[model samples]
Target: MTRMLLSVERDAIATAARRVMARCDELARMSSSTEGIERVYLSPEHARVNRLAAEWMREAGMSTRQDAAGNQIGRLEGAFGPEAPALMMGSHLDTVPDAGRFDGIVGVLMALEVVRMLRVPTADGSFRSPFPFALEVIAFSDEEGTRFGKALLGSSAVAGTWDAEWWNLTDEEGNTLREAFREFGLDPGRVGEAARRPEELVGYLEAHIEQGPQLDERGESLAVVSSIASARRFQLIVEGEARHAGGTPYDRRRDALLGASEAALAVERICSAEHHMVGTVGQLEAYPGAVNIVPGEAHLSLDLRGEFDGTRDAVWQLLTTEIDAIMGRRGLRWKAREIHAAPAVFCAPLLQDVVRAGILSTLPEGVDDPATIFSRAGHDGMAIGAITDVGMLFLRNPDGISHHPDESVSSGDVARGIQALAEAVLQLNADR
Candidate 1:
């Protein structure tokens, strides 16, 4: 059999990237929030974006459909017949409030580009012969968990890991998730049907902006992900007595805010002492937050991450232990609850090698060493990894900034990512 060169038109890929970026800007503008780009799960704006993406998929000549979970999937049939598994690629579409243009959108757009480039003429002089296996481009909904407090909601549903009880969950405004689903024209009960049988998936791939400075610092355009760090989030609440800020005697006051601040500092100190360990108190709230009043309660959320599960768990335990000691010493009542935890994920070795080879084959000369690093952030690939083999490619982010409006990746990096991704897909398809 003759080896077909799998290549994408540079101009066409650039055009697709621009289109994706435009859509991202539009989505960010809708439901704008002070925190970031607030496209909440199952909101009207989210549906609109999904519909537009579906239309683009169809226009690109792929068979597109929306799953019960509101995930948009575009399918390109394979010449090797229906018996072969598919090459599935995508990432989430949702973003935090006031987010940048590239974060999640790039992955979805690149998937579309892969499908467009792979389209060949059929034997009957109609559509071209498909690749060896089906190609699926998915735009996963609700990955940020900004609305429902659950990340990877769409991907988890498709992976058959989503809890049915989540349907009963309501936002702060009392809008149930089921109601949100109804508003989006999807049935909540049928979400389980979105799961793909193991036989249907040959492998999964995702290409995303680095969202960190690893690639930029290395002066490389792409990085093959080796692992995703383990993460644990905790809500720590400290209780004290509220009193007039000026009237409360320093000796008599049980200041919850002070205690919480001390705890946060301890977390930072402990994490810094441990190599490859990180801890952050990203969100905190104080009751009766007034200039003249002493805070009675302090509630803070701690996010801990590490490259190894044991290290992460140990750091978490240490943080909690120190918090207990601080509470005892400060004579403050406190409670801690675990909000979320994700284990470290290592990409499949074979798939990582394939991606590396593809990158080396496509990039400019002397761009030989692309960084191999573990992600400290979670992604849709993590959930999918639970069900099947998965891999990821990270494009350079010039400043290591993400989840903010200033997050960015260069055009040169994006072009390199497209080439690498295209080659990886082709190599994987040719394997079977």
Candidate 2:
């Protein structure tokens, strides 16, 4: 199918981009933290953003609702009526601790702008859609999983993959997820109702800041996502003998902390040698309180990722072998408990083509091709991919800094992104 030209004007794109930036600033102020943005699932901040998003959806000429899982949804029915399949677009509204304002918020706002441009105006104070499939924009309630330590809680329900055991998960304050649902004014028993059948959705498209420096390093504004990373998380524990630091000589000491430190370095060395693979030891703790005491135990968290599942596992194996040698030489016994694992999710070729055409439409003359990059970060699409096809567009983030206050994207880039996404929707219609 041929790509379609965008009908949206330059002024409209600029206006929408400005509006998105303004809304992002507005939402950033609603954070629980005085220091930086920190909105989590089932909190008062979540409710506040959902209400604000609903208002924007109505202004864009769509009917809005909050699903049983607390995800915010807005729908514009096609010519075939309400039951018709929908072209879905959106991203999560949740944020990690000390998050920047534009990570997921911009994607949800961009989806709204795309709908505003596509919905046809009628003389009778009503609107109509030219496409055969309905259009939906979602602001998912949870994606960062900061509260319960389980990511994709909102999208998992929508994908019909919600694990019943998740209801028992608790936060740092000892509040269970079941209680949080009731506190949020949602019935836990009805969460199953949030599931959407695969047939009801045509496909999913999301626009987000790159969260990395790939685009910025290459002097490009945007790129089409090729796939999301495969990931595995583990808690590693190292055990050794506890003894008096003052009396024990260096040759006689069996320090667990030293063993764990060596293992962490080994992780960096092993992962760096592999292509598209990365390992991070984000947290480390040593037992014993006093500065004079020798530590008997050490615990560290490992987060490993790669572009492919097989290669990711291979790197894990190599890491384990290196860690075993390090621990054995240090006279420490170590163990690793696997906590989480997810395979890489590739984008559909059809969706990739349309997204490429969308990015190309925004470029200057003679710039016909767009860059393609694999996302090292996890997204809602990882869970949503269980039910439907997914595609993503990435806007450049300066210095690749994310999850912090310094993260940023230019207003010009946001305007171009809005036009590109609108063009993508029109191209999808033409393909249909």
Candidate 3:
């Protein structure tokens, strides 16, 4: 934790919610897809958003730059100047296909608003001249893994966990990440420059939508996150002979599609047997397109996540055992590859208290616990947690929808988020 000088007076911020919404809507149109939102890592849309965000950062009275990994970064130095550590803020800028306007975009805009509110000079009735620590906002380039099939790439670079092999990663268009980096005006060789030493940051705070129904169901506007879930993904291939539907006898047929179907059902069954865990077969495809032919092979993607790593891994073990049984009974050969694994990340207790205080400061009396939900979704914090403490404030989403066009957030909630986030920063700085 870091300490800062405390003061009483400050400039007021009134147009936060409107500004956040306007910025979000503006960024949504910068998407590469004309039909829907799709801003992948290092794409033309990525560059456009970074430029737009940098301009906004400048308007908010901060210095801005794009890191080697292409994350858009802005910093407001504290009284101690550039050598002083910072309290990191903001979230990823890239979005999923047909995405809504507010998912990651709102966090960035809210952060900028916080800066705008802070930038007012002492003549206008502001507090703590020169500040105590820098406020750094990072718009991580990719957290959705939409293009490279690997999430947290930009954050990992900053966390010093960049896997050297990722340079060769290819998108659906067969474009290698290295080539894309070059095209995006970044040098792959200098990516390590993006990493911040452990001491360079006081902590990382991310503001995002709940992405689930809990906050909405509770009728609350904001809540502190306890933890982000651990997740593991697998690519499975089930192989069986392709046989003509008319020629193959029912008893003799070894259908790969049937094996995949059973496997999917098994995932549902086993995951339901546990609490705080989910298994999803998001993609399922069978080979031999002709309707007359039995499937020669089937491919499926399995995403499993849980509140704890031990529990998630235990489920994985059980799933593998179940898959073996299914393959043995079906007379099909199967192979599986583990594509991604990220362990659970817990919010720091100190930061949680700070966030709770901020929430309580804004919410009316008789509100329930500030720490109301455990995030089952992954976030950029998972990577930043490698080097520093992390905390999160989740805004309400009425429909609990995300990664889709239907995603939404209320202006009132955004306003609360802005106030809470600013208060959290000030309180944390004053704590020590």
| Best candidate (score: lDDT) | 2
Please rank every candidate by TM-score, starting with the best: 2, 3, 1
Candidate 1 per-residue lDDT, tens place, 1-432, comes to 112332426676676566656666665666546555677788876887788889878877777888989899988778776576788898878877777767888899888877776678666643422676788899999888888787889889888898877887787788889998888889877888888877788888999998788788877888899988899988999999899999988988898999999999999999999988889999888888998888899999999999999999988788879989998998898998998989998899877877886677656567656678888888988788878888999988888999888888776666667767877877775664
Candidate 3: residue 2 Cα off by (Å): 18
- Pairs with steric clashes in candidate 2: none
lDDT of each: 0.82, 0.92, 0.86
Candidate 3 residue pairs in clash (backbone atoms < 3 Å): none
TM-score against truth, every candidate: 0.93, 0.98, 0.94
What is the Cα-based lDDT of residue 326 in candidate 3? 97
TM-score of 3: 0.94
lDDT string for model 3 (1-432, tens) is: 221111222224346677788888889889888899999999999999999999988777788899989999998878777888888998999988888888788888888877776653545443221567788889999988889989999999999999999989999899999999999889999999999998999999999998999988888899999899999999999999899999999889999999999999999999999999999999999998679999989999999999999999999999999999998999999999999998999999878888887777676667766756789888999999999999999999987999889899988788878778888887787784
Q: Candidate 2, overall lDDT? A: 0.92
Comparing 2 and 3 by lDDT, which wins? 2
- True-vs-predicted CA distance for residue 141, candidate 1, Å: 0.6
Over 4 Å off, model 2: 1-8
Residue 371 displacement in candidate 1 (angstroms): 0.6
Write candidate 2's Cα lDDT for 255-365 as tens digits.
999999999999998899999998999999999746887889999999999999999999999989988899888888999999899999998888898898889888865
Q: Output the lDDT of residue 121, model 2.
A: 77
The true-versus-predicted C-alpha distance at residue 267 of model 2, in Å, is 0.9
